[model samples]
Target: MQTYPIPMVPGPVVVPEAIRQVYLEPYGSGDLEVEFVELVTRTQRRLKAIFGTRDDIVIQSGEGMLVLWSALKSCLVPGDRVLAVATGVFGYGIGEMAQSIGAEVKTLGFSYDETINDMARIEAAIAEFKPRMITAVHCETPSGTLNPLEELGRLKHAYRVPLFYVDTVAGAGGVPVLADDWHIDLCLGGSQKCLSAPPDISFLSVSPKAWEIIDAVGYVGYDALKPFQHAVENRYFPYTPSWQGVAALYAAAGLLLDEGLENSFNRHDAVARFCRRRLVEMGIDLFPAPGAVPSPTVTAARIPQGFTWEAWDRRLRAEGLVVAGSYGPLAGKVFRLGHMGSQADKELVTQALEVIAATLK
Candidate 1:
């Protein structure tokens, strides 16, 4: 059997050995049905706690993009205006999804090296477009920029925008995101990122106001959130749910809670600081401009002037370390180092940096 390299990529992070054991157990049978239901219930509650929201939460059987698409489909109808804030690849992706669903999409873009920190510009766009819904990515993983979502959330409330959708897929566990405090109507996250679980499971939290809008739209399908709503309300699986994924996520959540959310955030903060310090000591430049808030979960740095990411990345992998490269405008300019969940440990960060320094040399 081939052993996987230490996963330091931005997502599908290294799962804890204890959590991986959950996968070895057989799927729930008739005798274990109630136990499985309780597990799901506990997972949902813990997810809401992690999100810092009391809103209805759903665990879906797909990647984070599924929850993002479901939010757009459930709330937006033809002719509705959507003002999407694009700071990086995933931010631009929100506008693309909105447009694909036939909503009139307007984007407020920022340079890949900066975050959308200007509330004035976002507010101006909202005023000019009069959008029914607004989308923002809390952390643009590609750029390693963390947008000011609290201010934007407050802005949305001030504008009386019916819905505020946020992609916190890369932010939630590593940083602080109070969905209720920020007035975020719809917030989505994935088990793969920061949560330290395997891929194929995503979760979302929906506020009552957003639920009202979703109900009015009345869309129903495999991708719709309606079935998830029914599942939550009726306490049953909407379809054949992924019990293994749920269990894994549940175990991960328990670990986070046991560690304490504040401590986890602090740990991520320390890891990010350590990584940046090491990079600077090596005479490397970070991707985000000065004054731009970097993501606590990942760090994006420019590749050395003469070294291409393809060759450097391959070299690092040969040394048994795995990092990520950028996409979109940053494809060749930058590479990403993820410091979240299990990979956020000091030993991992130090080892990855050692591999990086050697590869670059």
Candidate 2:
């Protein structure tokens, strides 16, 4: 394997040295408790700010997918129906999770490269199925497409039957996520994306409406905490939490807040635009559609014909750049460059594009 001078691929983007300094502090002391609790609480608040919601946040001990499954199993019952506005892999997965939890899943699946066109179909399905929840991925990373979340939220509200559950795993920090204004019920995000932290930490914000629904049902065995009463034990995971991931997540949230939410979104938006502009200047075609509909957190491009995907991957890797290949059906046909985390800067993105141009020769 040849090695280039630059390290490519998004995340595990170079962790900042200052954030790493948190682990240097002593642990398991009374002081540690104060620091840890404050850190977690503050991070939750910062997440609320980014989500633009009064919804309560839960810092779960696993990947965003785990938290996502938790929401499905907790809110839905055996006979309840769920409507999923699916455009890509993650959106499909949300529908599957609802199905696994015994809910009847009804998906309005769109082509991989396109956004969900049939909001009317979604509304019609809700009316036909009378579903209790609507699951959606705010940005479908697999296709690099952004769904119309505000409109979807509005539709769910109008239907008055199903609540909206948003998976903002890729879109939270980089895109505008107005959970309150949009009337989103449950929203989830991960630390590894725009927060520029490690992958283990993920968060979920539950609105008052969600609580009412869940309270009417029962408890979610995984990470259920009692909000109103002191007698109920807040059941966290059966094991100790990831201290390092938590500390890094808190520090990353602090960094994100310091940067400010709007600034963070604009930073990612600008980088994504730069990438698209450079691609167009190079005479390379993007996946399709307007840049606005594409995910601001990632860019997916068609691999040039006649060149094998593996050859291009090897060429880029030899130059120390590591972009992602498309999944499943998209494999070999499309390549993805993540703009989240530390790669959310123009310098890094330009360096990546430079590597690609050179590799093409």
TM-score leader: 1
Which ranges of candidate 2 are over 4 A from the true structure?
Answer: 1-12, 29-35, 223-239, 290-292
- RMSD of each predicted structure: 1.7, 2.9
Q: Residue-wise lDDT of candidate 1 within 1-361, one digit each (tens)?
A: 4344656888878888988998998885721477777778889899999999999898888998889998999999999999998888988989999999899999998887888777888889988899999999999999988988888888889999989999999998899989998998899999988889888899999999888888899988777887777664466665777888899999999999999999999999999999999999998999999989999999999988777888877777889888889998889889898898888898889988898788767
TM-score of 2: 0.90
Which residue window of length 10 is worst by lDDT in model 1?
A: 28-37
Tens-digit lDDT string for candidate 2 (263-352):
988999899989988987776778856633887888888887656789888888877888878776778888888888677879888899
Backbone clashes per model, in order?
A: 0, 0
Error of 2 at 130 (Å): 1.5
Clashing pairs in 1: none
- lDDT, each prediction: 0.88, 0.76
